[model samples]
Target: MASKMTSGDLDEQFLTCPLCMLHFRDPRVLPCLHTFCRECLQEWATKQQPLECPTCRTQVSLPDQGVDGLKTNFYVNNLLDFVAVKKGAGPGVPCQVCEGGQDGDKSWCVDCAAWMCDLCTTVHRKLPGTKEHEVVPAEVLKAEKDVSKFQRKRHCHKHKNQELVFYCESCNALVCTACTVVDHRPGNDHNPVEVSGIADDKKDKLRQLLSHVDPRLKEMQDALKEFDKETMKLDSSRIESVNQATSYFQHLADLLQKREREILSQIDATYRGIGRTLESQKEAVESGFSRLASARTFCRQAVDYENEMHIVEIGEQAQRTVEGLLLERVNLKPEQDKVQFSERVSVTDFKNDVERLGVVSSTVNVDVSKCRVVTKTPVVGLECTSVLETADEEGQAVAVSREAVSACLTGPKGNTAVPTQLRAKDEGRVWEILYTPEVTGRHRLEVMVKDRDVTGSPFDVVVRSRESAVITIGSEGNEEGQLKKPLDVAIDGDGNVVVLEQVNRRVQVFDAGRGNVLKCFPIDNDGLFGTGTDSNGNLFVTSFGESYGIRKYSQEGELLATFNPEYLRHPLGVAVLQDGRMVAADKQQKSCLLLQPDGSLIREIGKGQLQDPWFIAVDQSRGLMFVTDNRAHKVVVFDLEGNLKFSFGKRGPNRGELNGPTGVTLDPAGNVIVANKADGRVQVFGPDGTYLRTVTTTRGAPHGLALTPDGYVAVACYTGHCVELYRYK
Candidate 1:
């Protein structure tokens, strides 16, 4: 049966079952839209109680009837029928209608799904029931191009003999004419419409879905192309690095080879010179020994056998020869024979240099996650910096060229400003961005590498005017002008100083310039934490002891109102917005609360991120709120909508590091001035959270701080219990 169809006829694998590895038998489609043989799914369902689609691993929810209840894949069934028909059209197929089951002609009964002989085919066509069935010859059926044209009419499952002709829109099912009258009665609950009409409506909806999906598919294809391009670039970079390393080591190897030859030649020349000196000394010693032996022989002969005169003469000659041989200085020791190997240069130093030779690096790209803004807040005339770091996939810092990095600043109304300078540091691993803003407002700074935004790019920068410390307000004492454990301070619209005292529960109103008590108001609350003044110059004090709430007071020491928000526990610092809303930092809750004008809960800011939230300051011009997290030792910035913008400072004693930050306020130029209670110093930062400078280092712990209208900063010292006013403009 397989030999009748060529491999080019169709892909047999598509029609093959993945589980049984054979032709599909009664294919059943799962909810995931994957189809498998009914028996195969039934067998699988037994082993895996909660079955998942084998192809996609999606969990399947089968009908109560199990695998047999799954929807039949009619499309796959039609294709299988088409293939079978094409195969059966060949000769040698057994006849279905003939009694003897003789070999049939190349004719098929589409309705009966069988082959028939010539005589049987004629007899089948004459019968009334079989006459309407499609009895096409194998050659004609094989010539049909479209598989969909071979679709057969389906019958209702309950009514075996009835064809399904109606589609129930309500139930989203197909039904027969009899089913429409019974189970699918034409009503609101069972609207059984003609299949043709409903199918047209479904096809239109499908077309609309396709229109939306096509654009997304195109975008995905483009992204894949981008990935391919990146892969190619990596390949090119690797090849270039390999070439460079090879050339460098090759040059070093050549130099070492040349040095080896020179040293070896020097040793050989020195050895030969020492050899000549030893040879000459050996010859002189041998000659001296031969002369001495000859003289001794003559003296012995004269003494033993020769006449007395000969003996006497030979004795003197022998004596002279012996004496001369001893005095002739014939050296028996080796001369210049030591040719030891001694290093002219230190090998240890050379080895160290070799160890420190060129580093092998991979192609590092700009890592958006590692890039950040160095200067959070920028001044109108001063430069601010944003640092961009490049790294490999493993996050190891690696070099990237300065030319690859670019920075742009956009202010209100989309005014674009370019970076003043781009400088590379840390061997090109870090790029510093410098930009100066021309106006004081909220601006966005975007740092990019290769036209891609770095992580945390497009940072919001609030530029303000530059300010400095000018004066010191009060001294330590309990007198009229003196304060004791002053916890919070605020400046009213009338330029009057309102100081909240922890020891006496006194809210003192003082002259902004002379620091003299104008009107001293006594609060009954024992746990006064912070003081704030609204636009109408009305004072608002945050307190928490027996009862926790914010109290509004008139300038003349009369309590106006009290707001007790349910979520505001342990209110420490409070700031009033121009719209009558209040923001309070709660120490116990470790978060900030935004309250409506009537102290209704608006939202919580930095809920889980903050620890020991102490003070609040609002930058209404940029719609930002700055909170000092004392224990966290950082200032967290949030938008009016409670979205976290950024945070700056860490726990340390350095210039930019904050140690127990408290009493946060904005200077006239919008710079964040935070008092460090632990370090006894007040530090200033740009609007973007970059540490700008220190305002003043107090001898006492500074708590609540506020900016006076006349360019002065009023900081309440908790230990000294006095308000110190500094020049801040």
Candidate 2:
């Protein structure tokens, strides 16, 4: 039978099926408050050992003998009935009020037995004086109360008209009002609602609230799962590094790349010549296209007039070109495409060959291309030649230097002794005796830096040496006015300095010439991103993932795409390959990720035996990838197809061994420089894993290191406030 059902004319939208993801009709509301469709449940019950509700995931214990009885529910039948009537398949009644609400508060009159609203009180008494038609509110009716039947089955409420029938004390039911007046009311002062099922109703609601709270609490637990790891809890190791500020770019290196220089310079010269030509052409076009001519003369010249008789008379054809004194030739070449500006600002860099070192953990290995760091003590001679003594009006220009060295003896408190192993330039012998350092630890050897023009600036390079009695040298820092150690460094295509900072989540880009920061872009605030620049000047960053994935950003630092697929976990290193693809090394996930240009997931590479690929480097030309595993202390090699090819390095503090090596770089000469962050040194090795010399950094906590194309070493130290640029002397 169909039934008309409505709830005040407002239609309600329902969630259809979780499987099909549609709005539900014919809802089969279960006791668990989850709903499904009749056909859906029957299909699920077809060949089942046991039946269960698909929505609430509740197990159903049906009687084994009768399968049909437990297959469908009355609630679903009611929904079907309502829809059938809505389509005019059955009765059409205006159900202005909903059948639900106020716990079924409205009740049907015994005379009519039809539903009635609160305003239908007058109609409810249609047949008045008929023993005050037994009445009750709708909520009491939900308890399945029938007032007439209940009254007939009990005593009157006002008069206690049970004829003194006594209520049974054991049974918790109303017998007679006469019994309540006599014995029931006085004796039943002890928790009466307990017997009336009110206590049971309250208990049911409390149980419902408890069940609801549990799932919400579980959802919160899922969100906090990533932070419950070993690494994030510990203090970062390289918080104590030193620094010196310098900027070394790789332009000179590009100037000598075989025929590449000549080709590019030829193109540049052609462009310069084009610029000169465009300037002249633009002037001519502007003068001719201007409105200096008369408008009527210009309009007359825009068309041509010829007569057929004149053409025939002048041989076979005669054509005359129209000319007005004010009108000239008009040549519009579409404005040369409006001198188009690059929509993209090549935040990458003005130059093309240089690239930023990707972001990495402080526990990865770094390589120095062909650049080598060596220690040598230059010969010294102190013969004060007074070329021309001039009296100083403002001040006299003199060489001033201060150094702390236990290797060099304190010469007579004030005057420093010039070592005996020196000869003058006039002696015709320049490379004479070597004045090596005396003591054992890292040393600082100083010489007075002087410029012939008296306008040159001064800086220092810390000399580091062991007991081999070899002279040591390092690029300088903290020289009263210099910045301390830098936290991180990234280089763009033009060899511009970009730093992924620890204290803040900003990617800092600096000019190569001045070493001054030009722009800063912010990334994830937790500071786990590996940053790299693309050829189009876009910034690609890899940071730790909460739900396990990588995030990409534009050069202006806008979020482009994010994916949490089966890629690397806790990614730390990010690099853009030449093919516009992106790669990242995840430290905790122990793998690397590959991303398409649109930030789509395009296969991940290097997983499984990798413990912690803290930093990843890509040599796109060779289709080879290098990932540094911090705990294993080796570099895992992989091809573009995610195949494991080879591995390098082991866990140890030996010369070739890595001790929490943090940064890795491939110099133009194809050598690898490992910035052993813990060892305070950069270990250089050949491309074939040959043991090259080590350039010891005197700076503490030297975490990041890179080889500039110009053969300078750029190091990021944690404790120092600035990045140090080094030139190998």
Candidate 3:
């Protein structure tokens, strides 16, 4: 059974041509069940190599006679006739063939294309020249279905009473039967065929076209689903990261509140002390004024006595009393109060010790070199290299290898460094970049292709300090003058090496003359880690475990003062300048602190730049410091003011490379000596961070390094059982 068509369906399917979307005129049908106007098909065929159905893109072999050779849709012509009659029946329509009076149309002549009453249509049919003309009853036309497919009359413009019946293949035009003999017959190549012959073949081709479109549509749908899944994952990750950040900042906020209370209490105590002293001074001045008032009253009463003798006797005593009171007032010296309060009091230089406060920052770092890569998965550590492809306006990949790809690295100190090597692979679609970073903390790695950022570009690389030892020192033992798990080393004024061993809590002094033990002393507590010497031959040491402070000692091992500042925690490296200033690197604070000789903190340097600074060496003449950042795999140089001059070395096993570098010092020539604990080698660099040479290639986890006055470098090896001394210039 055929499905019933509504008014809307009839309007779309029958009333208009598929090609021109207008009322059908001379409608022709192809075998594909689609219909177009004769003129539209002829024009469309001329543009195509082989005629094709415009709706389905089906290829068609044209009849030699062109468009007119196709079958005409007669049903469409009848529908058009019905619609015209219906329109003429409306109130405004008038008969075109009427002589004077405007008569409503009752019938339509298909050939003459005239609307007339019953009289006109009858007359038009009876005329000798129009007797064969086709006329339809106006009321009968209203019963027709499929009126949309109705075709309108199209007659030859030049010839009278002739219908266009044939097509000219050579001229690609439609013509009347008379036109064939007059215009088209002159050409023998004008091969004409009936239009009905090729209609079935064209329809079959349209069915084949649908097969190619189905799979491509399915692929697009699948891609959209995958894209939605990835988008959801990205949103979930963003929410999780926000929650973690909130928790971390809450912890910092608590710490800040505690510090705020402590500082306020100090301010209150200062105010109370000054207020009490000022009150006491006010009381002393009031007492002196009362004595003078009593003296004046006594003198006035004596002058009121009745007898002259009485007056004279009382006057002398009164005079003496008043004079004594007046003299006492003159003799009294007022004490000016020296104590005063300042208009405003503040905690200046609060960052003098980093451990006293918390640092807030919003930077997040990820080290690409340490990131793991999954097979057949999107790139994680660095940006995905796929975005380098050329894309269309809709962001779909269109072409590959559209531009040159490049990459650069910027260190934590804002120094931009070009990659040591950058090369493309996989037909210029993939790139490999190599660079060495010099500073610790967050570094930025950027990849660009054609002046555009690659996917997930500008990766944050968190670089850690290197930990390597150059030479080995004393072996582990419990005997006197023997080292056991030594943690720190320092050089004395007399060129003796001071070593602090944590396991046995012993401090051993080794004589540089024969590399023999000179003296051994025991510390009361354990966890001692850092040591240094002042210009006056005073030794300073820092302990981490039970006793957490810096300890000072005389040359003869006599205990001096222990400085336990509230801001010093987990101190690892200590250095003494020629001006009696001390610098200590605090591991917990991740900063280096400068202090006075009395252990009062002056300022902190490299609060965010130094990561786990373990050992330090001072070049007094050059006013510079060399520090080994144990976790960042670099040696950082700084001036006394804590400004970073430069830094060098990266984590690796090769020469001039540092891995777990722990011990650091400077030679007489102002060259840097570093100990790599991971590779057990000593690498030397020039003052400007240029690799000079290697000192010792074999050692076992050297932890502390010290340079003697006589040009010998002593290393304290934690794992190796012996101390090795090398003379380096």
Candidate 4:
């Protein structure tokens, strides 16, 4: 029956399906919290394997049964039922059960989902099937405003007559009593329990999720408002710049008429660029805010109105949605370039140099494409130089003050290093930039002048940590000299390649230049993964499985001590900092632990940021640590205190993409060398996490990698079962 919505009731837009643009029919909610008709979603899902929500276009991982497996929007259903009863389907609604004439007052059958006349209601009561059904007088139901009190008991779609009495915990589905005995019988795959028994716990979990999402919603709202303010500021700045140019040009109107037009045009062009950037940023903020708000509302609705089974079905998707939102870094400040008109002329100067009277300059005037790096490759701890020749709008080099030019070097974990000198030459047109990097890795050199970025402000710079290896080492074998499943590699202070074998359960030391095996020691355990060395020639190894711990050893293969921190589970990679502290990456815990030299836990790093932390490398000189998260497909960098500086990489086969990164090591210059197990490639990045280049693609999957003192990268290949050295300078 059709129902009329009043002004006081829920908005029609909320009840209307996005796909059909009609009142929702069996409304179903997506993980992204957008609602649509079940049939509409089912039809849409048929077009794609991983369904994208028609409203938001979010990728949705549909349940095994597809759209039909989606949980019902009980809140919307209840509202629809309430609105139907309140409006009486537009006066004298005929009894649906009897299909009678519109003559007598009707009573609403909550269970049968129909309207009945008084005579029909009496007959319905007399019928054995409808004896316990709730039949309320239409007038009385219309007066009721509490929608929760009108919640209908859900029934299994397979057995329409039987109510859903059991919730299958394993499959997270609701089933009728008869269906539970057949499909959801007590087994490993299907654990069915009473709906009432699991309700409280599910509700509590959903409530907790709501509480977590509420703060993020507020954050998104605040960020949206901030972007709005920035938009206003951008407009104000644009107007101010135009006015400044107008006022100055008016005084010299007759003498600088043509110049005035050119300057104002430059200002307009810059404003348009900045405006577009600001608008894009604002749109992103608004989108994030809207997504979070909708998801938050859905979480609250599910907890308050949905049945236990429905809650369980949506729990995983909801958790993923919330977790993904939390990981998104909100841009609190506007990043658009500032628009301003600078007067490069005085009255006397303008008269003398009319053609060059007033040059319009901005951060965008540097012409990044025209700028060149004088140094081909920057080596860590060494002086590097890049030349920037400031240009006019036409790309002609023009003179500008040193203060107008700025160069910033950014590294992994968001660490920023500044150039030592920005010497202006060639009549202040050509800038000679000089800087020394302490750590090696992928870094960006952002050159800006007059507050705006050059065309390509942030230039990719890969700082080499070490030169390529001059030799190779190790071969696959079960013998003492042969390597088997070489999972991790480290360079001792004496420049020896220390390899950890996973299957052989041995730490084999080999000479740097040759493949000769120097010494070997049994690990006496399985799941050995990572290895590292300190300046004192001591070695540290991490292992999991049966014997999981961080083991310390001397250069002579003597076990010094073993540390099994109570909280450290599945330690994968280990590194010893200059200060005698230890850092270990725990794959199972999804974090890196900082410990004292004596094996006491100091603190955890990248706690919630890493998904599968496998290996770690450190630049103690700069107080930075780099971690390779295998599952996350990124290298997360953190400061000494565990504060995330930044992270880079993603899942792809492209140049910079990291697919299941396994081993990470830093060169003397802080260049980060990483081995990707999935792709079998070893990539080099600057300290800032910028992918420099792929050193080499191995025939087998690459694991633990290390940079030797003599300028060689020793990579332990698990599948190849060998340590291959590559020259990396």
In order, the Cα lDDT scores of the candidates are: 0.69, 0.43, 0.60, 0.77
- Model 3 quality (TM-score): 0.35
Candidate with maximal TM-score: 4
**Candidate 3 residues 251-354, lDDT tens each?**
44544456544434423332232233223223332332333343343232222212222222233333443444344322122222121212121234333532
Candidate 1, residues 59-117: lDDT per residue as tens digits? 77888998887766665566687787767666565666664444545577766767777
Q: Model 3, which residues run further than 4 Å from truth?
A: 1-474
Between candidates 1 and 3, the TM-score winner = 1
Q: What TM-score number comes out for model 1? A: 0.36
The list of candidate 1 runs beyond 4 A from truth reads: 1-472
Collision count for each candidate, in order: 16, 41, 39, 27
TM-scores for every predicted model: 0.36, 0.35, 0.35, 0.47
| lDDT ranking, high to low | 4, 1, 3, 2
lDDT of 3 at 389: 33
Q: Is candidate 2 or candidate 4 better by lDDT?
A: 4
Quote model 4's TM-score: 0.47
**Better candidate number, 1 or 4, judged by lDDT:** 4
The 10-residue segment of model 3 with minimum total lDDT is 359-368
Candidate 4's C-alpha runs over 4 A off are 1-14, 40-66, 88-91, 105-107, 117-144, 209-236, 239-263, 306-309, 335-337, 341-729
What value of lDDT does candidate 2 attain over all alpha carbons? 0.43
Candidate 2: tens digits of C-alpha lDDT, residues 1-729: 112223232133333444445545344433233445645555676766566656434455544543333322222333233332232211233222343233223444433234444445445556454336554444444443211122111233555424224323344333344556544554445112222233233233333333443443343233233223212322221111100000121233443244333433433333333333334334433433232221212121111111111111111100111122123332222112111111111324524532321111110011111111122322112111111111111222211111110112222222343242323221111112224433223323222111111111111112333312121111234232233334456676677766666555556666544466566665655644466667876666655546445566665668887655554557677777777888877666567778786656777676577886666666776677776676787767788898987777777767788776677767765667777666666777776657686766545566555555544566676665566665432
